[model samples]
Target: MKRIPRETMVFLLCSTFYRLASGALLVSLTWNILNQESISYFPLALAILCSFIPAFVTPTLIRRLTRKFNGRQMSARFLLGLAILTLVAGACRYDTSALLVTNLFVWLLFLLLEASLDMWFTQVQRGLAPAQVQRLSGATTASSQAALMIGPLLAAGLTPLLGNLGFSMMLTAIFLVVAAICHSAGQPPITSNDTGSDTKAQELPLALFIPMLLVWPTLGAFNFMLPVNVMVQGWSLLELGILDASFGLGMALIGVLVIAGVSGSRLLAFLSGLLTLSAAAASAWLLLPQDLLFRCACLGLLGMAFGGARIQIRAAIAQRLDEAAVGRSVSRANALGTPVLLVVLLIQLGAIATAWALPFLMVMLSIALLMRLALQRSQPHSAAPDATPYS
Candidate 1:
């Protein structure tokens, strides 16, 4: 794969700043709250739903927004807004009732920022040759995961020292300052209509998009509740940090494997789906009263399956859609799946109320994930032929 330009690297680093802020907040606030069991299924579900709902409209919104502001400017505006909202949320984190309301707004702000980032990065990747997509995606994925790994590690040490509210305040300040710096370093706008075609071109119908969107919910379900369950099961913060780190490690490791031999073609998608089933199976077994080493192995394996599938899925999308449309497509998928993930996670928590249900839910999520892969394979490739390996 060809290397993306140096300008693109700067762009990606700025984009990753938002995630770093999010990771800090999540580790400080969300993880601590889950440890206390103060955040139940209902509130968590509502929060996730609110967070992802914007995905549905983000694509269309970004399409128009990018046309007005260049990718860099749009991202700067998003970061500025996000930084402000995060500060406000941090200020109100102590007020239980008010915090919930603020959290809702925070979720909305993040959704907007994330959707915009997705769009911005998609544009960057689309501009690259087909061979470059895989490398660029891998690099971005590695950068994001690196932030994730660092976020929790920071939280594990800092949270216990500063306490939740104090750490949250710190996080808020960090995000606000970093975002400002990134905004100031924004790049010039690029030409938007690379295709040179006007609105007269026929657009792909939403019906064709729904199946792809469905994959989000399956992933959302895992993201929403996995950490909470691990915390609930009496795992130490350090242990949880390690587990989260393992997830990142698995993703990075699998990305390397893909560069070596994994095909992003249709055949690979089918195999990825079948492999996901094994991940679920391992997760289920771990949930069922297992040794620590065994559980760790399962979690790592689950992350591996996700790593392989995620790269393939993105590549598939990049192949099918235009460069400008890639971000919107990803945002749309994330938006559509948000509610489904929230609802399923809620149900899983309810089951947990009766007993330790992590193992069973792992089994269930595995089934759903596998089904998604199969569905992806059965669906015809809708993307126009492109040389980009990362969608």
Candidate 2:
């Protein structure tokens, strides 16, 4: 197997740290908002809605930016801008109106950071062989998951000591600065011929789209509801952090295993869907009960499902699309599903009955299962003989 280049590794590391800071900010901001005496669900929902805007807009913006600046430069500028925004958000933390405005800008910056990193990785992928792309993609995801594991703990510890507003923002800004510096280190340009137009293009399998669309919103809804669940259960920040960490750990472990060929993607997706479905059922039937252990267990299951499903979806895309198209394909996939996710968030914010949440989750699970079965039935026998079960 070809070794991943040193520069590529550095870029991945920077991306991981950026992700860590982003995740930490998200948890802290959401916690702070929800903890408010007034309980600002509309602002929280609006913030989430704001986050998705860059997903639609950034692709075109990135294309233009890359014309003037290299990927590394673009990423650094975005990170620095994000750091500044974090400080501003911290300064404005006391006023609800200011906080909401700052939070919206902060999410926009965060999304830009993600978009820049995605563009950087897509370039890196263009330079590697298919096998290398698969390997590095898995490694990159696993590292991000590891960051997720650490981020919450860092946030929980810092929030109490730093007072959840200006101080936490300052600390997060420092992390972003570090990420900026690391990302600014130049990487060798990918010059691989594999990304050329002559390479045969395969239509993305319909089955892959199932996980692609559902996994993100499913996870989003879960995360969106989590703080409320934790509060209702009377759990402390530390416990909530632990639950968040468990989910990340599950994702990291499962991602590494799937990348190593321990299991097939479809099978993992099926199992994950079932696990998520079961967890949702338990949560609903039990009426969002207060047991910490049970909550942790459910979170862990959700994390594992998210991790596995993400890997499966990405891997399937990698298998089908050339490097040039992978990034755009992913962006399109996410864009297509944004409306669905928005509706889920809207429902949550509208003070819709909690009873409806479980049913919505079940519907998603059922669709995933049916899609998997349909994919299997659609595959011809000859293709089956050559296909890796996991692929």
Candidate 3:
């Protein structure tokens, strides 16, 4: 067996920790606070919005930091910030007055930190061979999703014994600290090995912008559509949860295959995911839209496609950009995509009576395909022999 790289291993661990704190732990904390009537859902909604306020500064901050810190150093800085914020948030566990403020800062730091980790991972992946990059990124994505699943179960088992506030905060802080430590350890000297500062990598690709603008809302359609489907059909929340889990299952299944050294074209990966999603949505709407079992299958296929698209998109970016440029490009893509995603979601939400999943999927798929084709024609980059995926 080939030895896994130190940087990749650390990245997987950090990814795990990030998902736990961001997804499970925060949800747990919010649920507890809501149970106590210490805070309302509206403020929590606002907290989420405010979190992305820092996105405006990310491109500039990352560019300046990339001049000095290696990938690990950049990740460690943000992780350490997240650790501290997690500690501070413990005080808001039951306090009505502090809950809003704590949530605001904690979520803000969490997002910024996540973006930094994306930068780190992108930098690391570009250094390895294409096959190795596939395995490692797949492993990391799987580990992250696993953590989200495992964390809530762990919280359920532990909350009874140790209580919520102290246990959650302490464990989250410690977990983040460990992630930072691991990411910082086994570091290779930059002068000798790292190429994150390559001159060609400094410029963000022009092709990425329009395509990215289309990508997010299309991918995010799954999230908005599924919930509405459940509401309209009067399906059980348990079934909804299962459907969600099925999506993750699809992603993990694909990741497992990639980790086993399966390879394929980047362009195919991206397109197949969108097409699978479109086909599944079309099938579900036409045939078994209300059948829980069939719906689960469709969601699973959609997830697999999404998983493939995610891997290829990041790899494509890393193929062209250095650490800072990758950070700038991704962060910008996310920021721009977020608003369009929100708009699409809100339009759907406002017309819940008419927001069928099939139409949404078809429209987004069309836009995504057109933008994807336009970008491909302009760049001519995905044809790199190594960028080719499964034969």
Candidate 4:
């Protein structure tokens, strides 16, 4: 393995810590909301929809923000703000309206921080060779997945001692503070060339966006269903956390082994679609009669599939677009897919088990098949002899 750069190492460390905290908070928040007597699926779904509002505009927002503030400064500020918001949310956890409002802001801050980190990653990739970019991207993704795997375990251990709100507040503050320190200490100088030249922008292939459109909703629906399943099954919060951790482990393993090794666009897309379909199937199975071990297996499979698909889709997009266009292309994909998520959330809110699960599974499978066809059709036209490898 090549020696990782100091800046990259710092960035990855901070990102990993942030991801851990975010993952824990996600589980804790869902558990808390579901456990509440007054809370119902509608409000929770609405909150989720509101949370994704930032993703719809992330590309435009990041573009303008990066012009005024460098990635490090922006990320640091967002982290600090997020820390403050998290504390406030924890303090007001008993108030449903307050929690909902606070969580929305939390997601907004989180997305902004994500945008800054992604922008920095893109800029950093611009300074590396293609092979290095692939290795670094895989390593960074794997590290984040590792954090995600650990996060739920931490949440499970801490929730008993500190309570859900207290755990969330403490974890967010600690991790965000460390992340802020890392960002402040290792702030990279942004050169004028960090943004791409003003040459005519290349058209991003439609096939590149297909996976994002299909996979995100599948993942989102799985997340929505998991907490509900836990609630219906009368499982403990710790079990929920563990299940989430299992999913994270699956993602981490795939990131390290599969996505890191694969390179061809068609192959990546095919794998991404296949994994997504598998995740959806697993999610549907989770709603069926099964032993504890079987359920756990399904959760693990879901995680692995979701993780593998996510990395491949990202790799596919990166392989096709210039570094500068990556942000916009991804943001546009998210924007287009946002409504799909809203619909999925609404379906979940209805709490119709078979209706939602069956349709979701069918749709996921259909999309996966379509994406495979799309990739196959586009490969002949798009693949270049000297094209960058996606591995």
Candidate 5:
């Protein structure tokens, strides 16, 4: 793989830190709420769904902000705002309803911040060669896993000392301040494209979005079903943690290939396209005997398939779209995609209501995930003009 620019590496580090802080805060708040006997799933679900639904408006927010600010300035301002919001959330930690409300806004701010940051990254990557783009893209995606694992660990350690809100607040202020500085150091001088839409932004191939859209629900089912399966079999939390870690390991393994900028054979890309691979893994997970090792293997497979597919889709999108349009395109995807995920997750919740229906429901989900492959195949393979390793 080509050497990634130092500026890009530092920018990625900034992005990772911001992601880690946001993830830690959100997870900490949600964990506290879940432990409360008085809180119901409806409110928690609503809180999450509400946080997601507002993301459709992020494009408009980014458009207006970029008119007055560069990506670095936008990131700095938002990071500071998020830090303040976390402090406010700390003040409201004693009130259940207030805490939920605070958590919702905190997530909403994070979403907006991410959209702006992505715009910045899109602008920055424009200076790189295609191969360099691939490396940076993969590294950013791989580093993103920090938000999932390290973020949660941060929440756990901090919660005992300062409580959820306090740790979140402290981390938000500390990490985001540094994130702002790194972001400034890493970015180019404000280009017109940074402050406005690119006139020459290419039209994206929407067909590629199928995998990105399926990404959420596919993973959601995996996330939703695996725990239920573990509990039904009366497994310990340690076993569940191990299974989760195995899945994370699989994701990391795939990330390495992506970062190395490995390419796929045409035959391999065709046979192992996003939907097919995910369905195979999901099916194996649902059908195979519930041996812990087997379940772990299946989950790992699902993670690898999901991560590889997601990277492929993103690389294609990056190849097409430019600054503002990139952010808007992603916002649109989230707007449309998350609703599907919400629906799928809701169905899974209902399916798990009865013990007999667990495996059947999972089978149905695997089938649903597989059905997309038909749509995928129906589309022209030329959908991605650039043949990526992930493709």
Candidate 6:
């Protein structure tokens, strides 16, 4: 067995923190605040609205900072900044009148943390051999999901003792302190070891970045519609939550298998197309009347599809770009895509729309894109060793 690099370890740690925040308490924390009438759901809504803020800026920040500072140095600065910010926001979590204000500040801290992770992830992209990305990303994701499972339980157990505000504050403190420590343990950035080739990386043009940005949001739009569709079909929250957990389980299981097999580029791309098709088929199934069992199956299938696609795309991206560029590229993709998702979700929320059908459409379209890429990879004219970021 190969030893994991230090960067991968840091990625896993950040994943743990992120999952604890986003996956664990993300919705439930909002639910708690809304139920208590301490803060209107509007703030939560706004935070979601602004969720992609860091995605748009992070890439640019990396581009600028990496020229001067090594990856580890930049990551350390980012973590330290996030720690201070989260601590300050945690201190203010108890002010009800300031709930929205405090929440927004906390959100800003989160965005910054995300940016920091992206910076460190840049190191992972540059340092690891191409074959290692799948396991590394999978490990990062696994730690995150594991944290997700733990975070909710932690939040629940602690809420009883600490109150809602106190629990959030405690989490805030833990994340900041832990983040700072993790950064200190990381290795210096790739700039420290020059390959001695004076070749500067070709910057990804906006044209390329724009398409990548649009793609994920289109996929995300379908995800945002799932709960709405389920509710419209009159499924209870218990049913929906159960279905979601099942979906997550499917993804987790597949991801674990892929890591174990050390899945390769060809298999990754093939699965990308295959999974997109399955997701499309599952979404299309929603057009029919909802059968609880059938819907559960479809959700699980979609989860597997998502897991496959995620690993494939991540590998593809890592193959072509530096760590800083990859994060920025992904952030670009996410930032643009999230707004589209938001709009589509709003449309789904409105009357007189076939919003339920959108996920199927989006998935099918993504499948079409994947199919094209797969075909391109097969063509004799395709360069055997092109190094374009998109390749």
Please list the residue runs of candidate 4 whose C-alpha ends up more than 4 Å from where it truly belongs after superposition. 127-131, 185-188, 191-200, 213-216, 259-288, 319-324, 355-391
Off by over 4 Å in 6: 32-47, 53-56, 67-115, 125-128, 149-162, 190-244, 272-277, 280-297, 351-364, 380-391
lDDT against the true structure, per candidate, is 0.58, 0.62, 0.58, 0.64, 0.59, 0.54
* 112-216 per-residue lDDT for model 5 (tens digits): 666667676777687566656655666776776545546655666667788755686677676667556854574555544453344443544344555545553
RMSD of each: 4.9, 4.6, 5.3, 3.9, 5.0, 5.0
Model 3, 1-391: lDDT tens per residue?
A: 6676776677777677766655545545454444455333333333344445555666677666666776667667666666776666665677755666666566555645655676777766766776666667677666766565455455555566777666667566765776657555776543212355555434444444455444545645454465456655766434545666666666676677667765444444445555656576556656774688887777666666556555555555565555566666666666676666566656665665545553346444543643454345445676342222221
Better of 2 and 6 by lDDT: 2
Q: Write the per-residue lDDT of candidate 2 for residues 1-391, one digit (tens) a residue.
A: 5666767787777878877887787777776665554454566666666666556765566545555555566668777777776777667666666666767677656645554565567666654555455556667778888898888888888777777664566666666766667655766553333334644444454456555656546656766677656666677778878877877877777667656855443454555454565567456436755567766666565566566556555555655554334545555556665677788887776664472364246334634653463356446553343232224
* Candidates ranked, most accurate by lDDT first: 4, 2, 5, 3, 1, 6
Best by lDDT: 4
Model 4: C-alpha RMSD to truth? 3.9
Write one digit per residue (lDDT tens) for candidate 1, span 1-391: 4555766777667756666667666555555334334645555555555556666677677767756765556667766666666666556665555555655556555656655555556666765655466656655665666677677777788877887666777776777666665567645465565454742232333433443555556545555556665656767777777766666666666666555545444444534553664556454654656455555566666666655555555544554555456555666666766666666666766675432333334333443443454454445474332221222
Distance from true position, residue 208, model 5, in Å? 1.9
Residue 127 lDDT in candidate 6: 51
The 10 consecutive residues of candidate 2 with the worst lDDT sum are 382-391
Clashing pairs in 5: none
| lDDT of candidate 5 at residue 180, scale 0 to 100 | 60
List residue ranges in candidate 3 displaced over 4 A. Answer: 29-47, 88-90, 94-100, 155-162, 189-207, 210-245, 261-270, 281-299, 353-391
Error of 6 at 343 (Å): 2.9
**Residue range with the least summed lDDT across 10 consecutive positions in model 4:** 192-201
Query: Which runs of model 5 end up more than 4 angstroms from their true locations?
Result: 1-3, 38-40, 189-201, 213-247, 264-277, 288-297, 353-391
